[model samples]
Target: MSRTTRPRKGAAHGDSRPAQAARPSPPTAETVTPDGPRYLYGIVRDTAPLDVGRIGLGIVPAQVYAVSEAGLAALVSVAPGRVVDPTRAHLLGHQRVTETLLREHTVIPVAFGTVMASEAQVRALLRTAQGELSGVLDALEGKVELGLKVLWHREHLAQRLVLEDAQLLRRDDEPEAEHERRLEAAVEDRAGRDMRALLEGLRPRAAAMREHPPVGERMLLNAAFLVERPRLEPFEEKVRSLAARSDTYTFRFTGPWAPYSFVDVHLGLRDEDASLP
Candidate 1:
């Protein structure tokens, strides 16, 4: 038997890969102190002070703020001297702050738990990356990224394909003699055909898109679309319409989120420009 498995969502695409903008590493629990490290959320254009109230990582509450330089800002909060855990609460807290900015601004989101030793280090990073960061922000202005994942049920898809083209299977009733490799191959072929039909329905509404490799065998499509603000409704409506049009495949749709897949930000272990302790 040829069995298939799915990895945890967002895990197959490891985040340690190089990205575009340089950022501070997450603070270490042993070396951090309350009021010392600033936890980074994302980078934004100059904006009014934000006050969402006490959603920071760690045990105590932290005030989120922006360290701005040359019209760019790094949204951050004081940390309570601990390494931020990848707990549900912390991840949601990271996303909540970024989503808040998305309502009125285009931002370059940082990974969860990112931290700077001090606000001054964050300011220096903003100053150093100003030119490149501004260009990216300009490109992303008035746009947001939407995530779409398609998971296909092999048996259901094979059945649908058999109907669409009865010749898809040589013998419909010979289940006992079926070869495992052949069955898996057949499923893979049907998935490609379905992917084409889905993309034809989505690409027109997106300004740009990034396709991540599918996570597992059942995943037919895993992608992020960068869409203009004006086209968001049309894009979302199209997804709904497509969902209504199918049962063989399931659609997982999300966001108006920061363009994480599309943004090119890479801060390394020793990003010389990121020197602010």
Candidate 2:
């Protein structure tokens, strides 16, 4: 008895008109540019061969490009986009480029995550920073940086300290927790003081030494020494003697790196200032 309207084809029961076709969404930033020139990393050097080929960092290609200055070079590659997210591939690529170059030549390695808008910018950096660049090159020439990590076997050293601190050890006879705590504290303090004195005694024999905070169960002393190539053997021998004399600690030496910690271009001005008459 009630009037009924005819249903429209290709439309929902409640729709007033035919439904429109679904359209594809616009492309995302990730999908837009899948491949392009990526400013990967750089190195400072007097000269690098143009023909050096295909040094691979993972699956990516490693290529070397020179900067505008006569004594600088930038190692770069074509990345998958302008965005490089510092993945393992990227970081290792940076290390590989610098390490490979250092094997044959002296290099002032830039820290990882260096990027440029274009190759021209890379060249301009070389041209503008020429003085600073030259200083880094000169500082690193004919010398190598060695890393020495001195670690104390804490259990051994602690036991020895306990023996040495007889008064503190005797206090352990008291049942009071507070006295036990104080004794432990005194033992640790004496151990730290003795270790520092030992490290200080070894400094003069080294070109430079730096002590780092203790890590984990071992006390770590991280040192970087600039040793002349010929003197490397004697330098190492000194380290071994120090280790052999002490049963409390062991030394782990890793070396001949690109002087990453020691090469400070700013330090070069000190030399220039002294030379001025």
Candidate 3:
């Protein structure tokens, strides 16, 4: 014990040899390479279907591919490397694929800009999130999203305002003066107030409503409603009545979307979770 032990040869004097680095996991076929394109996004489906020729994206030929897992399938395309950024064209393409499928089969639309390493990864995602995916698909089945936009013809409303406001209409007979100008302003103010009341009255009937900010001297009210297929006709009839009653506002309806605005697939995640993959 007193003799002690000799200094450890390799470990002595604070050996300056660099530490061994941890080896990274081997890359799989689906692993994204430095120059490889992103996988983008994944959709939910029970099984992948057979390849059905190439779909055309303008002049570019886009091949449709599918990945299945846990009774869910994802339809994918090869995105061009040059246009990796999510542009209008890319988003529209994503929507087009889902929309086309919805015409015949039920589909749960994936959020835009989803990419995976390979079909395997997509399958893995589906397997892990099977419950959520199933729920989403079930909810979206037999339902479509519709968009309605209400725009006011300001000139018409203003004219009606002047005609309806006795105080302002009487000003036209009086000599051009400050009182007439004040009267005109009051009439315009009253017209705006009345229009707002009408819009507010219609809010309850709408599933969701958003008033577009006044842009470049124009006013717009945009809304999206998730109406069942059978209810569409009645909804349109209500809209027609609203339009007839308010000639000042023009109603434009576009619909049968893939529930893009209503689908909430991130239910299981925590409040701070930002997992889009």
Candidate 4:
């Protein structure tokens, strides 16, 4: 599987790869100190003091290790600074840590650039949110997220519609706004029908599905599916079947990575809850 960049704030974006990092709500406060601030990567179920490697964010990459408490572990590295910029290097570093954990455990990904005051704060967050975190982890066990984007040849379809349907033809006395509205309605109707059919075909293979807005006019469907690890090949095969049967649509399939699209737990700190994006 190809490596993926971390999802950005507000919108979750991933390539045709298996490693899109989650976009959790960033912590509002960060202290840039020499011996404080730990960058959090994700939460897992192991309680052992596990160290992955020296593949973390920094000018000199920090060592990523697990901070365990109450049958849970938070994958973390000491921050180079408290407030990390969303640089390409930093995002990929964050992704690398999560992707590594994904190979062995069910990870609940924390948002990119998340920092706690110290290791104690990290432990505190884990101890406090243990129930919610474990519940989400149980729900996502052995599951991987897959993304599919279907784009149709709109101009080609429009030409076919003009020849095959009377409604697609320009009416003699229709106003421009009315004509535009009718055309848009037609597009939506057609896209909706096509998307629904595609969803129905693949829904059985997925435990859950989330749909995102199409990026452009030619894009008909942009969605993510949560599939079991053992059924990945079957899911890919199904996607291939659908794509093979379509002449006007092109399918972009990616992932068997961390369940970024499905995880929704937040790490709460002290007085108020710090939201994850």
In model 2, state the lDDT of residue 161: 66
Q: Residue 77 lDDT in model 2? A: 54
lDDT of 2 by residue, 1-277 (tens): 1111211222211111222232221233321444335353445553424334455344555554443344556555544455556778767776667656555555666555545555445555655566666666566565566676666655676577667766556454577787657666865776668667756656665566555555666645666677555556676677676677776667777766656676544322221111100
Q: Quote model 1's TM-score.
A: 0.77
Taking the candidates one at a time, how many backbone clashes does each contain? Answer: 7, 0, 10, 6
Error of 1 at 60 (Å): 5.1
Give the TM-scores of the predictions, in the order they appear: 0.77, 0.68, 0.64, 0.80
lDDT winner between 1 and 3, please give it. Answer: 1
lDDT of 4 by residue, 3-34 (tens): 24423323222111221232222222232224
Clashing pairs in 3: 39-115, 39-116, 40-114, 40-115, 41-114, 41-115, 45-72, 45-73, 46-71, 46-72
Candidate 1 per-residue lDDT, tens place, 94-199, comes to 8778776776677788877676777767777777677777778778877778889988778887677667875556665666446445656777876787788888
Best by TM-score: 4
Q: Could you tell me which residue pairs clash in candidate 1?
A: 19-265, 19-266, 20-264, 20-265, 20-266, 21-265, 21-266
How should the candidates be ordered by TM-score, best one leading?
4, 1, 2, 3
Candidate 2 segments exceeding 4 Å error: 1-42, 47-51, 80-83, 172-179, 211-217, 263-277
Query: Whose lDDT is greatest here?
Result: 4
